[model samples]
Target: MKKYAFAASAATIALAVSGQAFAQESDAFSTALADGAVTELAPVTVTTPLRRPTTVLQSTSTVTVITEDDIEKSAAPDLPSLLKRYPGVNITTNGGQGATSSIVLRGASASQTLVLIDGMRVASATSGTAYISNIPLSSIARVEIVEGAHSAEWGADAIGGVVNIITKDGSTCENGASVCTTVETGVTYPWGGYGTVSTRGVSNSGVNFNIGLSLLGTEGYDFTTADNSVHEDGRDGFLQGAFNFALSKDFLWGRLYTSGLYVRSNPHFDSAPYADWMTGETVYGANEADQTNAAFKVGAEVDHSDTWSSVFELYSAFDYQKNFRDGHPEADTHYDTNRYGLSASTTKEIQAGAALNTFTLGAEAYRETVDSSVEYTETARDVAAVYGQYGLELDALTFNAGLRYDYDEQFGDAVTYNVGLGYELVEGLTARASFSTGFNAPTFNDLYWAYDGSYVGNPDLEAETSKNWEVGLNWAPTDTAAIDLVYYENRIDDMIAYVSDPVTYIGTMENIDKAKVSGVRATYSQMLFDDRLGLDFGFEYRLPKDETDDVYIANQNRLKLTAEASYAATEKLNLNAGIEYVGSRWTNADNIEYTNYAQYQLGAYTLVNLSAIYAIDETANVKFAVENLFDEEYQTAYGYKAPGTTVTLAYRRTF
Candidate 1:
């Protein structure tokens, strides 16, 4: 049954992606697919918040992709809510949209998974990692999620894989020129109303542009036993604009991209467990936090000759953040990062049938400087790296290997490597295994950033290191059926951990040895009913041990299961549903024990959504969607409640 469901889901997605290409053919993911190898389906394209590299597969581990269609149908107000559809991934928050959202992958801490924005490292230099809840997804092109120990490919903070946010660039017009816009406004029964407006335009010069602004504010929802409702004061909005130019066709073929984002949100704290006895309200009720991020990049591909192609890029970014408590300034921070990288890769046809090989080599470097007024700190880190990747295929056997050497001011020198081999036993069956070594260098905040009388930084912290290995089998009996099973183990050496002394009330970061994780993942997709309906299923169990070898590390979960289905009810309408179950988890540091266990198992729930897009005319479109059809009461975080049921109606036109 699971396998059948998985196949159906894949079929539905294939249909959707294939059909959507007719409307917007210039999407990056679609463009990448035009050149890369196509597997059972295709790897999901994700640009984690870090401005490193766009990814398709976990490459080194497990990965999952959630499409833009899935986002619209789910009507999840924010990133945290939408990510709940994944099993091994957990989303916890205090309350409301754009609140403090924590993402725990494979029982790792919220700070373990590094979030990226179009390849740039956007994680807070002070907090180590940024909360995904506060980032809006209005203009998201797609999300690429890689799961596993990836401190190797990326630098610090990617103990788990990475979540890359790849935004949409401008699309080309078929005729003279065109522009489109959509505006939506809706009201929640008890909270309040929200609105969003987006516009995109393309000029005759082959320049594409897009801009969007959105606002969401709501009253709090009822807690398990509290009289004071979950409340959201002030409003949260994201403003983004991007432009793309063709440059030239012969001499310099390139594109220029730029984007700016700002978010100001009212802080919402966790409700006291015993709401009946607590007298004081959650502090920061009147607090506000603001973030401003801007990035600009110019990339060009010049043909030195016919066989060798080169890509050179120059980029710069600036970020500033401020937090206010009780309407007074509490902290302010500013960061500026500059980077320049160049890659020269070439492909040649070695043979026609027996074997083929492709190689890629590149050198890159970046410098980051951080200055803080509230914490009274100034720090800078520079890294220079050289890497190479090679892929070869011989009949039924395939191999991929990569190596990178990086020199950092704080960590000295480090080397990371990954190698994998896959063999095909039959037309539809293949087995593969891989082993990789990765490391995480300490962040600026881990060595600096101190406030109050209770905090300390560790300047001598050793780099966190890991050795990971995995074996798996993939089968596709037919084009309509597929399944994958993978088992993995990871050994982490000198893991970075923070310890707090109660008597002295002091907290400091330290390098602790002895950490390990082992897990198994199963995923399946299938098509049914003449490929009109589809289903997808995924299940994973991970045992991440701390220094004491306990699965309960802070607030991460050990078991996860996720399922999704979609049906093309008609040519004009589609119905989809998704549900995820997160098992019990605990935090020893916080002294919080989840009781009843089974009853407290997040109350297994389901969410059903329906969407219909109709073409009123050649250039006009009408879209309607409903989310949380059952109105189940649940919480992504410990005590914070999610929205009940919601609906959205929108209309768009192109000229």
Candidate 2:
């Protein structure tokens, strides 16, 4: 009972330090939505006859692709809300939309699971995690998710794998000249409303472009039930405005492109926890932040020949925040970061009797500068990296190898690599295996941050690394059916853990923990009734443990199962439903208080969702959806109540 009470009080503390960052690859995550009449139903991310319809990222055989169609028909309001419905993913939110959230992929925390928006990495240097909730689907084109590590190509941050976000662009136009507009509006059960206007076109001059504007606001419910010394009664609220644009043109020998995404949001949260802790006085009311995220990129892709190509780009990105308490500026705080980078890569393919060979070489350099209310010893850092890759394909076997070296001004030298192979075992079955190494660097807060009595920094912290191996099988009995089964293990060494003295109340970071994760993932997709009905299923079981503490990782479930069904009720009406089941998880990894009792467990929970889209015409449609169809009362985090049953209605049109 004591432990439960303490756990609840801890919820408020997370809101402040819980801000996170995400590392992304040069890739995508096949996202979630109602239009996936057949998601992950292909030999790769899609079935044959389908080459992802959209803008960037190289397609991989094991990735999952959620195309533009899926984004268009999605009923969920935010990305994280819908992400939980996919395989190898688990999500926990502080409350509703626009609130702080957490994502764990294949036992790797959010910081470990790389996040990329158009092949660009995004995250706050101090928080070490990405804020993805404010990115609306209205401005997106496609999302691809890869479940393992790609640090060899994406740097230390891609330790867990990658989730790529591709925004809307005119590059996919059928002809050299075309234009289209999409208007969408919707209302939610929490009494929120949203509207979006997006346009894309290619002109006669060969200038391709995409532009969009969106607004969303809601009277959200109190995001937490935790009780500190204060009381919060009013409903929390959320408001956001977003803008996106992309322009590109192809020349006889090359192509030039530029894209940008900017979003600003003010989300109300219960800051009573922090108020009482800070002022030692009773405070009541909703707290909020003027938060912003921005990214811009300009690049050129040169096609030297049919079998040779190269890409070079310059990019800049940042995350900003200013917190306000009880609508008063007296309690405000700020954190802002800026990053600029340059990258270039070239690929060459050649034919060698009976085998096709491909090679790639790339290099990149980036700098991060920070401005915060708290002064630190170091306010800037630089990273330079170079990498190479090779691939070979034969009649029955395929292989790939990659190597990368990085030099960080603060952390010094590090190297990473990956190797994988696949071979056909029978007419319809194939064996696959891979071995890889990856790492994650300590965040700015981990190494620098002026001493403030309670906590201090550790300039000696080292980078964390991982050794992983996996074996799997892919079987396609027929064009209409596909199956994948894999089992893997990962050992994370030099984990940066914070240790503190109980009596002195002083905390410091140290690389003293080692972690291990082993799991099995299996997925099956099949087409039924002549493709009118499609079904996809995924199952994963994992054991994420802390080798040093001799215990399992906290807040992570050991088993997860998911299923999705899409049915074309008629030529004009489509129906889709999804179900997710997550096994119980431990609430804490250790008993810091030594209460002589084991940790409590959050009970298992399941969610079911239903949605239907009725086409009014070729260019317009109406959508109705019900989330938490069963209203299962469950909490992904202790002391926090997840949203209950909610309904939504939306209308969309394209021309």
Candidate 3:
């Protein structure tokens, strides 16, 4: 890492004395820095993963950070909306901001992605997933996304990746003050407009306070291509608040933190005609859904010593949804979940020759309680695990190994492990490889979601476990140019899915025996013209094999490509643009054949986004952005159309 500083400093001096011209240059350097330049340092450290600072590149797993500067430049409305800019992430949204947002990584479902707020799990055990839309983007300091399985080190709900949201802390204020405040307001157009206001301040007593409220209304587009049909379109608002306090700094110090969210939305899903199947009658009906979500999290972290730490966290979340279809009574669905856990770990670093060897050991236990009325399933279970990690540096090579054993009342026992090896092949080149295993317990809904006389519930179901292998190479041709290539393969045993009896229309969760997913990614970035301009390009490809003798899934894309560029044309001016292309794929769930289908292909679409900002003095600036420049009509969800032609104009002032 010291070598990186030396290289960056030398390049900075050259760029400072030179001048260049380019439309835009893009890379991690541009998006990760506070002012689009690594030379101008910020008070916050650059490598914090979740809540603590550490070397990012040397981590056992891949970590990608989206700084506050990146979010402000891109002008994304929420966290889920911003993740699409990263490599190897697939996002699906029902509509604009605060909507149903889902993420798929390495061919795994949205539920496989574990979301964390300052290292504590935010996923709902009842539905077995996180309602990402409920998470406000206002007070977030940074986001650290660690990609890939981490059951060995992170415990459950980590099969795909971990999205850790690190909120703003008291130290972010000026002069290390005990009190500070910040407020921002913005608007957008669609149905009605939108407005938001949020504030954060700290007390000299090591306490922090934050509150946010937003109101937005939209007169959504038509459900179909009809002249006078306004099926269902409405507006919604959200309120979120959080508080954190730190006690003394002695042996028995204490800390408390809490956050709550509330939202109300009316979304249209499908079209229906009014009629009675058993009786002849003329009726008028509409398709509409009203949904609400309320969630809260509380946690405390205690540091017992220089080498020991312990944390206890608890969370509760609830969701209610009702739908009206074709002149019938509203169908209601309710989901509630409770989660609690405690973790304790110790880290020891000892001098070994000329280097340091680190060892870590920890134990954790958590419980999930889920209840769903329509699902007709009630389940409760607790899970406990113990893990250890060893890291050592020998000559030019670094090695990391971890192991964990977990026992669950509902899923029996499982073992997870990981091993990583890295070697500095040359002065500017490095090679690395890692092997790990992960597991995901079946969700209650997947086991038992029933309707009418049909039901699906397999009491005896095995957890899905995956074995993954990855090898990668990183190269730096010069001080300002870096490139990387990685290949990964994942295989799963006893994957669970819904199986149905054709005659009875009854479905049951069953093990699929085997499934395989493999992929590769290539990324390149460079600072051109002596570091005044930047450019970044990357591509990812994935292929999933069912491996089940009786089933097949279609509509899976084999490739995704992303390109971004940023330019600091002048000391006071900055501009950026990004383009993404997602390949076409199929969408069939079962091997059984059906006639007269359009193959359900989502056409390949290209999206272009632009941003420009000019600094006014030192405390104020004007900004502008245009999203979906071409107004491309695309659908990430099966039948839902994405937003189009959004323009934003705003101003910012820093005190």
TM-score top scorer: 2
The parts of candidate 3 lying over 4 Å away from their true place are 1-53, 174-179, 206-217, 222-329, 448-452, 549-555, 590-595
| Per-candidate count of clashing residue pairs (backbone under 3 Å) | 29, 21, 12
Which of the two, 2 or 3, has more lDDT?
A: 2
* Per-residue lDDT over 46-159 for candidate 1, one digit per residue giving the tens place of the 0 to 100 score: 323112322222232455555555555555656876777665677777655545667766555566677766555666555666656556666565666666655445655666
| Model 2, C-alpha of 462: deviation from truth (Å) | 0.4
| lDDT per residue as tens, model 3, 478-507 | 656666677888777787777788998787
Estimated TM-score per prediction? 0.79, 0.88, 0.83
* Candidate 3, backbone clash total: 12
lDDT of 3: 0.60
**Between prediction 1 and prediction 2, which has the larger TM-score?**
2
Question: Candidate 2, which segments miss by more than 4 Å at Cα?
Answer: 1-62, 171-177, 226-231, 273-286, 591-599
Candidate 3 or 1, higher TM-score:
3
Q: What TM-score does candidate 1 reach?
A: 0.79
